[model samples]
Target chain A: MSEKQKKASAYWKENVRYLFILLAIWFAVSYGAGILFKDTLNEIKMGGFELGFWFAQQGSIYVFVILIFAYVRLMNSLDKKYGYDE
Target chain B: MDVQTWTYLLVGITFSIYIGIAIWSRAGSTNDFYVAGGGVSPLANGMATAADWMSAASFISMAGIISFAGYDGSVYLMGWTGGYVLLALLLAPYLRKFGKFTVPDFIGDRYYSKTARIVAVICALIVSFTYVAGQMRGVGVVFSRFLEVDINTGVIIGMVIVLFYAVLGGMKGITYTQVAQYCVLIFAFMVPAIFISIQMTGNPIPQLGMGSRLNDGSGIYLLDKLNGLSTELGFAEYTDGKKSTIDVFMITLALMVGTAGLPHVIVRFFTVKRVRDARKSAGLALLLIAILYTTAPAVSVFARTNMINTVSNKEYTAMPEWFKNWETTGLLAFDDKNGDGKIQYVADPSKNELTVDRDIMVLANPEIANLPAWVIALVAAGGLAAALSTAAGLLLVISASVSHDLIKKVFVPSISEKGELWAARGAATVAVVIAGYFGINPPGFVAAVVALAFGLAAASFFPAIVLGIFYKKMNKEGAIAGMVVGISLMLFYMLKFKFGIFDGGKEAVPGLEKDWWFGISPEGFGSVAMLVNFILSIAIMKFTPPPPENVQEIVEDIRIPSGAGEATGH
Candidate 1:
């Protein structure tokens, strides 16, 4: 393979890895804590909130925002590492 | 001033601001028309996307729906917002790098087929129109309730304002006005919420207020009080959900994927200058959207609690003037069954004398809380902003589908730029009138069709676009087959279950729910259809020839985030 193709492939591989990690967290918060394990999590409480219900309504959304910004920070650094930054 | 005068003033001022922005940002070329010349800043695009994504439903109906549905409504809260994560991580950066004017542009180029492009256009139009009709109706609802105007007249006025900006400035005009609209809608949504939050819990922030102790000297958490009240009326606990876990999971997945696939939202990323800007703006858009989303549940808790307290077992004649006003609008009604002069809003359908429409929760919130007339009126203007901004954005997508995707790419490839621009404006004009007609005379199936739009989008575009980018070997045959099969499967399922067309008809729908595939609702069936699309596409690709080498090269190119040029028609 050409040097450029190899570097591109490497960059793409790293990008895919980051996506997997980030999306796992995304899945864990919303589907896991918020839905599937909700009954179990609701056994705990945070102030006025049941732990599971909070994740379903409010907590999951806050985590989603944080996940995106975190993805942005991670992707930016990766772009710079791969010298793909403009 | 009273509510009418305040509404007129605020709505008038906000309309003038939109018109002013439209004139300032009018598109001159097809590129400018499609993507604001691909030069919008991240902050501006972020705000525009927020306004564009948060439609009339988000502004006028979501909180109210959440208020009644309680924990079950998290499907919307999580579904809508989680899609931005998919967009930011999986879709936005790549599509922005492709430098396309529309979603179909990428599908067409990547699949190397006019067939793929046309299929995409049809899907985009169907999804957009289904969604847009709801927005126009929202505009009409807001106008009639606040200004006391006729619903048809309200729709026409909405049509005229949208026609002016969307036809003249296109996406360029829509983006800037949406920024202004975002400011208006968020401010309008937040003010009353903050007020109610303080009144109920002594917390200024609505999100925290929901979890704080009530200020009524009861020292109980607001949610606990709401739960107690709900149970007292034979309703489920406020934080508990009634939807089956499988259905909730599938529905949330469908909405998130469908949201990522929406052409109007996807096109907003094209307006930015870089792939990085696309990523940043997705983050910003979600952050901006999260502001309203997080507060909605708090507003829901407050509104539901206040509603039950005010009217339950209360004498009908003693109700507030706002109740009478809403009654005249036919959104709220009290029949006082058993001839008892008091309203009974119990869980039992037979005993529930007071029938309240969920759509009124947010609109009537300010009046229910006795906020100032100006704050009440501000919601009217805010609803208009949300509706108009989204309508304009969808209109742009519809017009672009007609002019750029169909005319330029398919039928009349030899057309000049100026000629194409005129065609776009003409399409916008026609789309607005059609949308206005639907707004004035909405079909009986309008509400049912809205959820179907998300299912259709998920079944078709999400799979097609994802495969086009991620799997280099995916051919036109696979994509075309997948889109056709996916969309058809979704429609068949939706018709069979949602409309009961394959059964006896709409009346048979309740009985057919027992036979749902794996107990998933029609709204969540998109996930099933999408999975079938993915599987069938791969199977078809294994037999068919792979996409051309150049197409594969384009896939590899979009993977890197550098050198994204201006969004172009070609």
Candidate 2:
């Protein structure tokens, strides 16, 4: 393969790795903290809410928005690292 | 001015703005009609997508659903927003790189099968039409309540207004109108939320106010007070679960995947310029959506607490005007089953006398809080905006599927671009009328049917699109088989459990309720269907021949970030 093709493959691999890591965080917040461990997390308080209730109703959504932007930033940097940025 | 006049004025003004934008940005070509000439900025596309994504269900019904269902309603919240994460990370950028006008165009090309394209078009039509029906109903409700028109008249008016812009401007017109709609809706949504939040917790932001101590010198968290009131009335705790844990998990997963899979929402990503813009636009859309989603739970808390404190055990004669107003519309009913003048809003089926339709919580919220006439009118306009924007988006997809995918691409490849554009316009006009008809003469189960649209999208399209992009060896055969099986399984479950088919002409098949597979409701069954699709596709691909070399090359091309400029029209 050409050098540029090799570099593109490496960049794609890195991108997938970042995607999985970000998605794992996404799964943890919504399904894990919000639904599965909600009762356990409810034992802790954040201001006026049980931690779990907050996660289910409010916290997971906040995390989701943040996670998207974080992924965008990570991918942007990865693009630069592999000289794929337009 | 009275609330009625105010509503008419605001709604009229918003309609005028939409029409003006439609005229100003009318499409000049087929590409313009399909993808807004592929020139929309990421931020503007984000706001448009926010408007497109936040349908009438989110604007008018979600808080009400949450208000009644309590913690179970978290599924809608997590499900909807979480999908954007999947979109941003997994789907949007690649799809944007593919640079297509319609989803079926991508599916058909990527799978290299006309039959696969046809299946996608069918799924897209069913999903879009079912969803648009709910939006039309939302428009009708706002009109009937605020403008004093019959529901039929309201629906007809909504149809005419939508037909004007959607036919004239296409995606170009709809994109700008949706941006304006995003403004009107977010403003309308936030104003009442701020008012109620301050009144309840002495805080301005509804998100924080929901967690703040009550302003009534109770020193208790608002949620705690709500939970106390609910249990006092024999209801489940406001912060606890009612549905089984597995059901919640499954439903949330279905909604998230469904949101990602929805054709209308996914098509919005194609309007932007670059792969990076697609990612940015998804983030912005989620940020815009998060504003209302987070506020919805807070609004539920406020509305619930206010309703319980104001009406429970109160004499009917002393009930608030909002209650009487909604009662006139038959949305709020009080049976007084115990023969007492006092009303009891509780969880006990026998003792509860108040039957507040879940749609009323969001609609009646402004009046319930005694907000200004202008704010009430703004809400009417906001609800119309939300419904109209989404309806127009979905109708465009339906129209494009007919004109671009089916008629031109498949049946008559010789049709000129101008002919195809006119055909799309004609199809959109008919679609709007049909959606309006469903709105006026609603099939008594529009919302339930609409919920099934998400499940269908989740089961059929999400798996196919995701696998087509990520799994290089996924052949046309496995993809088609997977979509067919996934959609058929979801349809069978919905038909048998929800509609009660196969009962020898009985409306409800016996024992279906008790015999749900693993206690998963039909709404949650999409997740199982999706899992089956994934497993079936992978297993089938192992045995089937791999995709053609050119198809694999196309996949590799879309995976990269560069060279995503304008999309080429078929």
* Best DockQ among the predictions, by candidate number: 1
lDDT score for residue B109 of model 1 = 92
Candidate 2 lDDT over residue span B1-570, tens digit each: 989889888988989999999999999888999999998999999999999999999999999999989999999999999999998999999999999899999999999999999999999998999999999999889899999899889999999999999999999999999999999999999999999999889999999999999989869999999999989999899999589999999999999999999999999999999899999999999999999999999999999999888899999999878888899999989998888799988888888899989998988998989999999999999999999999999999999999999998899999999999999999999999899889988886677889888899999999999999888899998999999999999999888888787655334466776788999999999999999999998888899889999999999999999999798665
DockQ of each: 0.93, 0.90
**Predicted candidate 1 versus true structure: per-residue lDDT over B122-229, tens digit per residue:** 999999999999999999999999999999999999999999999999999999999999999999999999999998888999999999999999899888888998
Clashing pairs in 2: none
Interface alpha-carbon RMSD, every candidate: 0.6, 0.7
Top lDDT hit: 1
**Candidate 2 TM-score over all chains jointly:** 0.99
Give each model's whole-structure lDDT: 0.93, 0.93
Candidate 2 docking band: high
lDDT of 2 at B526: 94
> Model 2 chain B: which ten-residue window has the lowest total lDDT?
B501-510
DockQ of 1: 0.93
